[model samples]
Target chain A: MKAPSLQNTLLVTGLFTASFAQAAELEITVENLTRGIAFTPILIAAHDMESHLFVTGEMASTELQAMAEGGDISGLEMVATSVAADMATNPAGGLLMPAMSTTTMLSTEQMNTQLSLVAMLLPTNDGFVGLDSWTIPETPGTYSVYLNAYDAGTEANDEVRGSGTPGEAGMPVPPPLENVIGMNGTGVAASITNDKVHIHPGNIGDAEIDGGSSDIQNTVHRWLNPVAKVTVVVSE
Target chain B: MTIRLLRMSVATALLIMLAACSDDNDDSVTEVPEEPEMRTFEVSVFNLSANQPLSPIAVIASDGGMLWHTGEAASDGLEALAEGGDNSVLIGADSTLGSTSGDAPLGAGESEMLTLSLEAGSETSISVASMLVNTNDAFSGITGVDLTTWAVGETKTYLPAVYDAGTEENTEMAGTIPGPADGGEGVSEGREALDAVTMHSGVVTADDGLPDSVLDSSHRFANPVMKIIISRVE
Candidate 1:
């Protein structure tokens, strides 16, 4: 009986060491590739395979809505903690400007093998750049992934000045964006057409600044797909 | 306890034998210097836009030269190719080890394949470019794509982004475009608002309030205007 018990203890210890061997240190850099748009505080997390920050064609969770609509990540942080995910929040310290980049280091646990990131696009209602769950490669190397803008589908992209609350109808004009955005706009859309998260139909802003259908500038604020670039280096 | 001890000894002996076998195999497989050989690559470009006709495709393989860089002034060769649909200057560049050009303009939803061959010893890279002939200087391409590790039969696909040459403004005027939209002149020597290359902020057609534009809603396009597939055939 004593011999069997000792062998069991050895087996458990071996398994524990093997699981710790799978741990990895990751250096992640997120770059805002747009020429004019800015990204709100970014949330980078390494969670389990089943977890996701936001999924396309699926209704967004309330936490995703807060981040997409108001650039708030507190709710997401709580969710991450509940799932035992490794996360680095607000690595940019503030809004990441156009053509600027931010880097963060994340030490991931054995089960946390997937990565995700999200940040709101200022001057647009409920529009956020997102990376759904991407499986982290087991090999030690550098990899890059491009991100696209997605609409939370919780608010109308009215393109007018309004609140950032989840159910708002207009864009949140942060101080840095105040001078660049136009005013006295009628509004672009009245209701959400797609009730699930979907790829953003690029902003249809007008050239008129004082009065137009949208308060966003057509030439300055418009962007194509792949608005952000995320590079991840996996190291043991 | 005696059985466990015997089992551990057998496992250690097996591990040592496995290590010895691997070492012997490594010694037998010595590294050999690679000889310079002619390598052939097939590049295919597909137009994915609604009404934008792609200029004749230019495919080039070189050591490490880039056709154009963002935030930098366009090269004279790049300027002529972007403004006009003529790829002669780029195809005839000094840095290109091998180059090829499509026979004619590729219409929307059409594709063209061209082949290039280069002697391979040093690191090699490929570049591909084509102009959206309806616009002023909008072009889509991929530059400095490494082909060092690509297998002979392996193929890769890319959705390239559009760029503005900045040599000519996107006026969308009657005599500014070179395609069927306007049968206008090509390659003006004027430098306008921005003299450096940048990602194209899409064309604002006449239906979108650009009253002077000769383009209509059909001319508008989004990102990833072209699909490129590269394969090493030889």
Candidate 2:
């Protein structure tokens, strides 16, 4: 026990140090790919594997419904804070417009290895772009994930101008996007037929920009899956 | 037995020397000879349609560049592929490394495998494309997927979602669709009513209230219209 060999100590310590250096730092970038859609202030969280901000086919929680229906992230922010997640709120400082992107650096504080992002799609009743918990890779490389649009299932897709409060009747077209929306359009539909969170049937815009069944422009407002492209670079 | 032991010891020493030589070579690549090497990948594509038959597949290996981007207008080559399912122009278009096409069209519930081999170190990304021939200008595939993570003999499968080329309108008219459903026009010259590309709203057939549409409800489709798998075979 008293052999006091220096090389063995240095080797063991070096191995431990190398293991510590292997932890990854990620650079995350999110792009809004819609032609006319606007994303509300986004919320990105790095949390444990056991938690999820939103899940499909389940009833939307009060917090998620609040964000999806009204483009408000306060309730969801409170939830992420409750779990003590490494979170970034409103990286774009406001709405992320079509074809625009925002980047942020995420530092994972050990055991927090999953990433999730959420933002309400503007000019919709209750649609949002979502990237559910994706595992952060341990290897150093660039990874890309595309996000799809989801219905919050809390309100009917009336596709008209209305309130930003939860349980509202129509979509909230914020001030900057207000002028582009149409006027004098009868509501698209009036019933909350599907009550569970599911894939959005997509917006049904009409040919008449001045007076259509929906306020959103069919040519400019329609979108496909992968509404947002996210690029993540992991660094050792 | 002594000779066998000698050979074993020689092999062990050679392996150690080789490992050391590789590490040194990593630092001094100037002495290494540069030779042309070939990298190959096989693209397995599946048609996930009820009735809409896809055109022959077109696979291209290119640099980390995009063949097309959403919210932008389509190039002439992409316009040709979207309108008619004729990949002749796209296969030879710009931003291409190497391209391969299927022998025949893929019908409903069918599959096709096309092998695309590229010269090693020539390209960093792969783009696969094909047309949903029954629609006006809808196509589905992947673009600019980096290949550094892929290795020889490893496979990666991708389920592709449909995209509107934004070159032609989704008119669904009788003489507009190029597939057997219409046997109509392919690659009409001119501009579309809307020039920007977006997610396809899907085919609105006569059953869905588009009376002039020659297509039926069977032509309808959802997000992921095709399934694709790529393996670096060599």
Candidate 3:
């Protein structure tokens, strides 16, 4: 019995070392592919496979809502830390403008084999660009992934300038977006339609600057799928 | 007979030199000249929109050539294809190695298959482009699809999204659209307000509060308005 128990301990130790040997050096670049939309401070996490930042068709967690609604990452960072996840927060240091990109490096720990990223799209209420739980490849190579805009389902897409706090009604127009976004709009939507995270239905912007149904510019603020392009380089 | 053999040997030597210069990984040199192999591909495009009629499809095979890029201005050839249903400009581009075009417009829920053949091992990518004639400067197709690794008889499918050429505005007004819904002008002379290419924001028809728009609900569409299938036949 003692010999069997010793072998079991050795087996566990061997597995631990094997996982540690798989730890990778990763360089990630996030590019805002939109022509007009701006991405807030991005939060990228390398975590275990079981963990997820936000899952489509499921209610968004409080941490995800905070980030999606207001571009806040503190809550999400705390969650990642609690799960022993490796994270690179705010690599851009500020907003990533249209067609601009930001890069960060992360040396992932053992069991951290999945990558996720999130950043709030300015001029949107609870809309964010997200990559949910993409499996990190074992082979060392460069990989590309496209991310889409997600509706947090926590607030109405009023399309008018308002608070960025959770459960808000209107979009949070930052200083840089103040002039670009419109004003004096009534509102596009008054209630959250889908209560679960899903692909954003897109902005229904108007052409009027002072008095339209929405404060977003239809020609400028709208976008299709693949709002962001992510490039990941994996190395030993 | 001796002179003919010498000419054949010289031609084979030149072919070997050109092959070595073209491909870095191809090291083996053939002692005898052989017939150049031909590779063929079949491309099928199916329209999925309610009312948007796709223009004649232009299929091009090249070596890493792209028709249009996001966040960039449309080329004159691309602008002509997107604004009007004409695909001649793109089919005649310099990068096109082998190309084919559909003879007629593919209507809603209809599909068309076009074939192209090129010298094997020369081109490594394929591109397809067609315009949604109902809207201003809206096109749907894919660019830079890698074909070097595709096996013979291998078929791949894709659901392509719509792209706004950005050469014209989405005014949806009369005389702006060129489809049968409006029968308006095709490509105008000048560029629109936002002159850089981007994914289309979709048509804002009359049902969506664009009062002056000539389009209706049928003209509106979401992402993936076309289904594309590519197969390497030979």
Best by DockQ, which number?
Answer: 1
Off by over 4 Å in 1: A1-21, B1-207, B210-234
Query: Could you tell me which 10 consecutive residues in candidate 2 chain A have the lowest summed lDDT?
Result: A192-201
DockQ scores of all models, one per candidate: 0.04, 0.03, 0.03
Better of 1 and 2 by lDDT: 1
- iRMS per model, in Å, is 8.6, 9.0, 9.2
Over A86-185, each residue of candidate 2 has an lDDT whose tens digit, in order, gives 8888999999999999999888766677889999999888889998789888788999998888777688777778877888788887889978888766
Model 3: DockQ vs. true structure: 0.03
Instruction: Give the local distance difference test score of model 1.
Output: 0.83
lDDT of 3 by residue, A71-127 (tens): 999999999999999999999999999999898999998699899999999888888
Best lDDT goes to which candidate? 3
**All candidates in order of lDDT, best leading:** 3, 1, 2
lDDT on C-alpha atoms for all candidate structures: 0.83, 0.80, 0.84
TM-score of chain A of 3: 0.92
Ranking by DockQ: 1, 2, 3
Q: Which stretches of candidate 2 lie over 4 Å from their true place?
A: A1-23, B1-234
